[model samples]
Target: MPGFNSEVRKSLQKAFTALADHYGVPTERQHFVEGPPGKALADFAAHHRADVIVMGNAHRKGLGKWVGSTTEHVLNRVPCNIFAVMGAADQ
Candidate 1:
């Protein structure tokens, strides 16, 4: 639903702002892009010529690790290096 998408966007924006503030990241350095996760990250990194993309990954094990992970997709598509932190599997 459009309403649901709007709510999610607002929630993400709020969380982004909060984290940026807590980390002392300037507003100009903070970006809240709305798109498919992997594609958005890849495109942003390429456009900005980023040296590295730091992200959280739900580090999976075995066969599960090779399938349907945004981190994997970004790793393959992004032009820059990636530093992935292990996050909860449910992510």
Candidate 2:
């Protein structure tokens, strides 16, 4: 499970890097937090005083109902509007 998590993190880093390069976006300030989803998000928002929360709406089925457990938790706990970017199929 640790190996799988590492692989996923690596893949996400590579993808984010590519995206930043392609869009000319800076990644120097990017931060990744691994913790209780709701608390993590709330902490980030409180510390940064972020005006909005942007998240992906992965349309998973079965036991993975809702946007995602973490995302749902953040949405409920955070004191700001959420901007969910759904996949094409979600439409």
Candidate 3:
């Protein structure tokens, strides 16, 4: 995190907060996690005993199925169900 951009981190946190607020979800539970995205999420879920994991899939078309993304990485790591929402182009 030595070179991490605080501005971008703040922007992403704001976005997450706004999105959660738009859906009437509490922003208090939102987190701007670091480390490997999938691992971070998986750890969070496990720590919180989350019943399900909802995540966006960002792997592009040409990327092989095994070519990793946060969604795929957490599939084998977490115990809960995963609901992946693919981006428009990914679909």
Candidate 4:
């Protein structure tokens, strides 16, 4: 299980690195955290006093609409700004 987790983490790191490069974000600014996405992200942002967080819409159905649990959770916990991008219309 630990090995599987490591492999998954490696894969995620690769993808994150590519995206960061594409966005012109430096490697020093990137952080790889463990634990639940919402809590981890919110805690990290809060601790670092992040100016803004850019995220993708979960596109949830019903009441949430485009907002998902993780995004909502982060929004509720974080004191920073968030820019949620809508997913593609076809998706």
lDDT, candidate 3, 1-91, per-residue tens: 3366989778877898888888888667766677768788889889888899877766566654334477777888889999877667666
RMSD of 2: 3.9
List candidate 4 segments past 4 Å from native: 1-4
Query: Candidate order by TM-score, highest to lowest?
Result: 4, 1, 3, 2
lDDT of 2 by residue, 35-85 (tens): 665778878987888889988777888645446776878777777888877
State the displacement of the C-alpha of residue 71, model 2, in Å, after optimal TM-score superposition: 2.2
Query: Residue 34 lDDT in model 1?
Result: 62
Best by lDDT: 4
For model 2, which pairs clash? Answer: none
Clashing pairs in 4: none
lDDT of 1 at 76: 94
Encode model 1's per-residue lDDT on 2-66: one tens digit a residue. Answer: 34577777887899899999999999999887677888888888888999988875557775554
TM-score of candidate 1 on Cα atoms, chains taken together = 0.77
Please, what is the TM-score per model?
0.77, 0.63, 0.74, 0.79
Sort by lDDT, best first.
4, 1, 3, 2
The candidate 4 region of ten consecutive residues with least summed lDDT is: 1-10
Best by TM-score: 4
Cα lDDT for residue 40, model 4? 89
Residue-level lDDT of model 4, residues 1-91, one tens digit each, is 2345777888988898898899998889877777788998999999999999888876567767656788889999998898888788516
User: How far does residue 23 in candidate 4 sit from its true spot (Å)?
Assistant: 2.6
TM-score of 3: 0.74
Query: Relative to the true structure, how large is the alpha-carbon lDDT of every model?
Result: 0.78, 0.74, 0.75, 0.83
